[model samples]
Target: MKPLHSKTEKALAAFACICLSAVLSFSALAAEKTYRLTLAETWGPNFPIFGDATKNMAAMAEKMSNGRLKIRIDSSNKHKSPFGVFDMVKSGQYDMGHSASYYWKGKVPNTLFFTTMPFGMVASEQYGWFYHGDGMALMEEVYAPHNLLSFPGGNTGVQMGGWFQKEINSVDDLEGLKMRIPGFAGEVLAELGASPTNIAPGELYTALERRTIDALEWVGPGLDLRMGFHKIAPYYYTGWHEPATELQFLVNKRTWERLPEDLQEILRVAMRTAAYDMYIQNAHASAEAWEEMTAEYPDIQVKQFPDDVINALRSANTKLLANYADNDAQAKKILDSQQAYLNKIRRWTSISEEAYLQGQ
Candidate 1:
């Protein structure tokens, strides 16, 4: 009887050891789990508002995820391909990217609509359209073929038309004119016989100064002043194109799918909040900088394109859009949706903000 009792005690001890080992292994696996992603940005390192957006998003995501998720961003200077963000994210060379969707128009023509339109809704209205309307779904559809996801990363509200060495007086003045512009706006300008070119941001100042490009449009006074374009070009035109220029965050779909549901939601929230934050930050900075520029340089001429020029540009934009609508089914769908939403929202704007401003 004593021998049998010893055998039973040994068996029980073995079983307990097995259970303990399994529990230890489970805990170890859980402890080791973390998601790390690499991001590429179109902007150079420390590129102010644009660069800040990515930094803010990464920081927020890390804090929210409690170290379970980490993001590392490589700016244009590191990657050496400012305009190649779309390709990098698609190839999974980098897990994510920050850029403008329009930059990829040559590769994906329909992508041109995702950034902004010539006479589209403003930042607030466009945001509403994105979240509450089909804007997001349409954007996803356009990017899906490339095996990537895109989000609204930031906004530069109402971009200035551009800096010009020569004043635009009539439609004919645009003939043979060279400008640094991008997206559908470039297309619109191209229709008017202007040579619309896109050069890297770092090279813009040199190109403008050397007459490689006659005119260039960066962001508003908020960003353009820092680039020192005002020191070279004298004409500062108000915005007619890109009423709300939104930048993009590109994610590799495979990398995104691997994340746990909690981390995914946290990332989405972080990016969304950061984008809205950038919009407000830019607005405040632009206002302050605009005032500063005007005071510092009384000789800097601020002018609008003459009515004939404006009419010609607007007509060109309308005709080019019509051509897209006729040729590309997807472009037509996206444009139709945007126009419909803009019509509804601008009506509200006319009664409220426009009315209030007019009275004031």
Candidate 2:
């Protein structure tokens, strides 16, 4: 009987040891995997679309990862200059960054397709171009040469032309005007007899205030109001140069590759969500800002350019497009591809975007 009781005790001990080992192994597997990333934006917190959606994306990414992957977002000057952020990410100086795609035109001429073009697709159409058309794949191919991965981060829909101190009555008014604009718009502005300067965001207000620049064009009403351009430039102009401006997020190819598949998918979803949020928020914010500015800043007059002025801009834009076709092969490819896609999608906008706006 004593031998049998001893045998039973030995069996119980062995069973308990097996259960403990299993629990330990599972705990080790469940250990968290944390990752850190830096997202940079050119604008401040009040800039609406880009800033607001970026914060939300970081928060949502953190939440979706369930503590397994932790992301640290430094929105305002935490990492680098707005334009500098893209290079930093491409070189692996930072894990990721956010800025408008046109900022890096020198690095990737095709990048402007992802950002914005003169009289190109709207926010929704641009989104469709990326997701449904070959836009994203083409963008990835363009970024491959730069050692970076790029995605559409946000959009401001159709942006305002810009704020002008003087009313533009004709192409003659653009002559010798020092305008703070960038991307293809700068090229067109030059064609239209204006000296287009690509000033950094922080320096624009000072440049305009010091009389170094005759006019400046930032995002739109909400963002421009924050910068207090209304006080300085009474004549507000339209952003016919930039019908729609899209923002981008760039990640180092190596760092992006290192991410687990699930985490990569999480990032893609987060970016799409951020873009959607940005467009919606900016539209409302611009309206609110316009209302506030009109009520408060009576001296700051706002008026759209006359038909003649718009017609001059249109002619300049056509000349710019022709130049791109003649001189830039990559630019021609992007323009042709984007236009082809738009031809197909613009049909739907009649009922979608156009009809809604007309009803309003």
Candidate 3:
């Protein structure tokens, strides 16, 4: 009877070992499987700095994940809908997107703050706020409700105020004038009685050239030189608005959740690095482009608005922001946070960077 019992126990143990081995084999197969994600960017195909950021992110993710993660990017030209990025990603049509946050302000008004403000922090200051301050949490609150996530993708430093057909000598020059602008800057201009409009990137040069639009602010010299705006617009104004225009990376909540823990970390690190790289790349490109423009384009005169005109625009911008803060609880919180941070950080900046630049 003892021998019979031992034989039965041995048989049961062998069967259990077979099942355990099968489970281990399945787990290994699942772990080794690859995940593929699709990204849609708001830039045209082969676009310089902006497009390069997305490509860099994808490359890093694949390399870090050891080929278990792959991302395919489709530029605006391929997707055929530059402004539809937010909606498409939200609807699961695209796993991720790269675009400026301010572009969707019409649909999500609170998004107006994330890109940049007329009198906001510079690139270094804003990056500190995003990584060490309330910027990330505030951004998450704004985007999470929409089943999406947003991160700082890149910064264009200070944007060129714009290329104008006429110099803005006073507040009177802006009144009743039509221009191509976007984001909160447009609202600030609207407060000053300027008719501000947004045109597609591809149409900007044509619109301004043909008098369809009086002026347009695309980007700094890094990109503007290629647009040929300098050839037509004689007065290239220095930046007042969009001091630090930071583009964003948007991810579908579902897509993010589907990623493995390791891959998710890899993606986050890649995006962060890519964004920082873009800031450097833009600085280099802008320096090079400005050198070229000065040498070749003698007609391109860089001008700053008069003090009075600047004061009026600043007042208008302040008024509009105050009105927005009064109207929305979230807006007020974000504005208050940003203002408070700027107040604290600007002192350090003034003593350090500002003083150094002045002495130089």
Candidate 4:
């Protein structure tokens, strides 16, 4: 009886050991599991500054996560939907997206506020709002219901107004002027009797070359140089539309939830770093491209909209913004927040950067 009891105890010990080993193996497997994500970009493959942001982000994320997290990018050429990035990511067709938030304004009015606004803050001031003030919170309020998270992907520090087939001398010149402008700026121009349209980046050069569109505003010389817009349009107007055009990264809520805390933090760091890098890169590239453009295409006339046109645009902008605030309580909140912050920061900016530039 004693020997049989000892044998039974030994069998139970072996079974316990096997159970522990299985649990340990499962845990190890779980620890080593890899998470792969896919990103869709509004820009086509090998696009310059904008496309570089996505690649920089992905490389940083993968390296930071030690290969446990991978991101695959599909540009517009592959997806065939430059403007469909928001929908694709939200619907889980893609895990992430790189596009501008304002592109979705027609679908979500509040989204218009997250991207740069007409006559709004510059890149530094806006970045201050995003990282230090109410910007991120307000953005979340707008996107939460849609099950999306939005981050500042990159900034094209003050964009050129656009390339115009004809110079804008007066408010009358804007009448029936067909231009490729997007976001709130388009609405502002529309209010002033101009026809505003949004065209994909890849299609822009063709549209302009063929005169399907009269004018288009891409980024500054950094990007516009490659598009060969100067060859078609002579009058290159200075910026007012997008003082700080910020591109966005959209993450599906489900995808965000699935990421481990470490990976989530890694993504945030990667995005933030890439965004800053793009801003600097754009500045550098624009400087170089501007030099080359002037030397190569001396006839590319750089013009600023006349005082009357500027006044008219400002008036239209104010009225449209006021109307939006009156119609939507959320719009009111966002506009008011931006205005208040701008009022506060502009004072300091005046003393610092603006003052220094004037002295120089």
Q: What is the C-alpha RMSD of each candidate to the true structure, in Å?
A: 3.3, 4.8, 2.0, 2.9
TM-score per prediction, in order, is: 0.93, 0.87, 0.96, 0.94
- Alpha-carbon local distance difference test for all models: 0.93, 0.79, 0.92, 0.93
Per-residue lDDT of 1-360 in model 4, one digit per residue for the tens?
Answer: 455367779999889999999999998776677899999999999999999999999999999989988999999999999999989999999999999999999899999888898899999999999999899999999999988999999999999999999878888888888889999999999988889999989889899888888899999999999999999899999999898888999999999999988889999999999998999999999999999999999999999999888888889999999999999999999999999999999999999999999999
User: Which candidate should be chosen as best, given TM-score against the real structure?
Assistant: 3
Pairwise TM-score winner, candidates 1 and 3: 3
Q: How would you encode candidate 2's per-residue C-alpha lDDT over 213-329 as one tens digit per residue?
A: 999888888678878888888888666766668788787889888888888888878877887788778888889999999899888766777888677777888887878778978
- Candidate 3 at 64: error in angstroms? 1.0
Better of 1 and 3 by lDDT: 1
* Candidate 1: tens digits of C-alpha lDDT, residues 1-360: 454367779898889999999999997776557889999999999999999999999999999988888999999989999999999999999999999999999999999898889977898889988999889999999999999999999999899999999898888989999999999999889998999999999999999999999999999988998999999999999988899999999999999999878889999999999999999999999999999999998888999989988888889899999999999999999999999999898999999988999999
RMSD in Å for candidate 2, one decimal?
A: 4.8
**Model 2, total clashes:** 3
TM-score of 3: 0.96
Which lDDT value does model 1 have at 287?
Answer: 93
- What is candidate 1's local distance difference test score? 0.93
Q: Show how many residue pairs clash in every candidate, following the order shown.
A: 0, 3, 0, 0
Tens digit of per-residue lDDT, candidate 3, span 1-360? 455367779998889999999999998887798999999998888889999999999999999988999999999889999999999999999999999999999899999799999988899999988999999999999999888999999999999999999888889999888899999999999998899998878888899999987888988999898889998899999998998899999999999998889888999999999999999999999999999999998778889989998899899989998999999999999999999999999999999999999999
TM-score of 2: 0.87
